[model samples]
Target: MRKYLFIFKAELMSALQYVANILLHMITYFIVIIIFFYLWNYIYDDPTQLINGYSKTQMIWYVIITEIIWNIVSGRKLCRRICDDVKSGNIAYNMNKPYNYIGYILSSHLGEGIIKSLIYITFGIILGRVFLGAFPTLNVLSIVLVILSLILAVVIDTLFIIFIGLFSLYIEDANPLFWLYSKLILILGTMFPIEFFPEVIQKITTVSPIYVICYGPAKLFVDFNLNNALNIIAFQFIYLAVAFGLCGVLYAKGVKKLNVNGG
Candidate 1:
């Protein structure tokens, strides 16, 4: 724990040095939310009309929250990093180190994302309030629940990224798989709420990362439902276990297959 804590702090400080990168990302974030704001507005000429059980305000806020989460917890970068590690022989070298390689990667990714999460979520809320008005009513418990769901969403998203990235051991590249996963989340959840989809797609999304990763936190933030929050968090834990186990199995097998430097 202490060793990984050091790695976490080291990565956090390294990420802090890249302030310009954060600024550039925020610029894109601004453009994205603005685009969606207008698109949704045009879709709902009558702001009061409910499309698939979401009011205009609810729908707009849903997009905002989900986009924020998606950007902060980007799985593509994690997948790429893992692939690079494998290709560059870093994964093999790290295996000889005292620390667990997967733990190191996980800690580093979370640490880097912490600052971005703050900046994005802060600016995201400001943007939402400015353009769409205040968020839906919520008490202290609801706020705590939303925050918890968001954290769960991040961890689960990261685990899935690690799971896909582990395929780097057997495949030439795992990034294409990540591409598919990210695009699914983007079209199915980030750009629009799940309710916007047809009934069949909606049912299918529940099993995919779209439900626990994107829609869960956004839905709770927009419309706090205790039962739904509990259910989402529950599913998140299940995915968490599945992803973690897969990563562990693949990492163990990969290590056994390592032939680094005439080992």
Candidate 2:
């Protein structure tokens, strides 16, 4: 456990060294918030109001929370790191290490994720205050649910990324696969809420883990309803279990096929 924590700390420190890059990434998302705000405002401009079930203020706040969760769930470099390590023969070194490789990778990611989430949430709240007049309501129960959902989002997202990373053992080129996965996230409502989707598409997205990561927490933070919030929490855990089971099978098989060039 200590060894893994050390690795996590190392990764976090390395990330901190690229202070400019981190600031740029955070600012890029702030731009995204502005883009969505304008886009949605135009769509909802009519006096009759095309969108129902949420006011403009609520919708903007929804986007803000989704962006915060996204900062944690997205931007993982696990798959790319795995591919690089495998290609460079560094995976051989990892195999001989005392720590479990998957645990080490996960811990490293968790550390970076914690830092990114804090930065994004702070910027997101400030952006909301200035641009959208958004503010979080104070409630202990709601805050607890938001935290729980955020943790589940990270776990489920990491499991999914690990599953994708395992493809490196089978596929000759993992870049194309990574590209496709990224595109899917954008189209499938990771950046924007799925309420923008058609009814049928919205129904489909509701079952996907990505929706749980972004939309579930966004809704809970804004509305703070107990019943639906609890339901989303339950679904997140179940999705996480399925993700872990799938990744376990893939990891077991991928290790057998791993090819290590010169030590």
Candidate 3:
């Protein structure tokens, strides 16, 4: 545990060193929020109007929360690093290390993301309030639940991405798979709420990773219903277990294959 914490600290410090680069990225994030702001504003010609059960404020805040969650956990480098390590045979060196490879990647990415997530959430709230002119109505308990859900969501996301990355042992490259996974999340989860889709599609998406990964936290924040919160939280835990198990299985198989290939 201490070893992982050390790795996390190292990665956090490394991210801080590149804070300037992250700030530049924030500019782009803000630009995106601005674009969505106008787009939503145009959609809600009347302030009292509701689209898919979301008022104009709720809808805009939904986008802000989803974007923040996406930026925070969208650790694309996890896949790239895994692919590179396998291609260069560098994973061989890490195989002898004390820490688990998947855990190391998760810790490092979480550490790297901490600073960026904080900055984005901070700016996201201000922008949402300034432009959208409202915030999610939340009490103490709901706020706690949302935070817990987000933490689990992050772990779930990391595990799935690691699973995809470990496929490099079979596919010889996993970028395309990551791209496809990302697109699915972006379109089904990030771009709009599940309610915006047809009834058939909505039911299917609720069972997908996107339900917990991108939609769960955002949905809870914007529309804090206790029943829905409990449901999303339940699914988040189930998906977390599934993702962790799949990652372990794939990684074990991939490592065995790597050894057999003598590479």
> Which of the numbered candidates is closest to the native, going by highest lDDT?
3
Tens digit of per-residue lDDT, candidate 2, span 1-263: 88988987987887777757767888778888889888778877753453646667777788787767656656446678877776777877887889776777777887777777778878888888998665767488788888898788777777777778767777744656767765666667555567778889888889987677777888787767889888999999899889878877877788888887676
lDDT of each: 0.86, 0.76, 0.87
What's the lDDT for residue 97 in model 1? 86
Instruction: Give the TM-score of each candidate.
Output: 0.95, 0.89, 0.95
Ranking by lDDT: 3, 1, 2
What digit string (tens of lDDT, one per residue) describes model 1 on residues 48-77? Answer: 898888888888899889888888887888
**lDDT per residue (tens digit) for residues 135-189 in model 3:** 8889999999998888888778878988999999887899899999989888898
Model 3: number of backbone collisions: 0
Question: In model 2, how large is the Cα lDDT of residue 157?
Answer: 74
What's the lDDT for residue 226 in model 1?
Answer: 89
Query: After best superposition, candidate 1 residue 51: deviation in angstroms?
Result: 0.6
- Lowest-sum lDDT 10-residue window in model 2: 46-55
Error of 1 at 169 (Å): 0.8
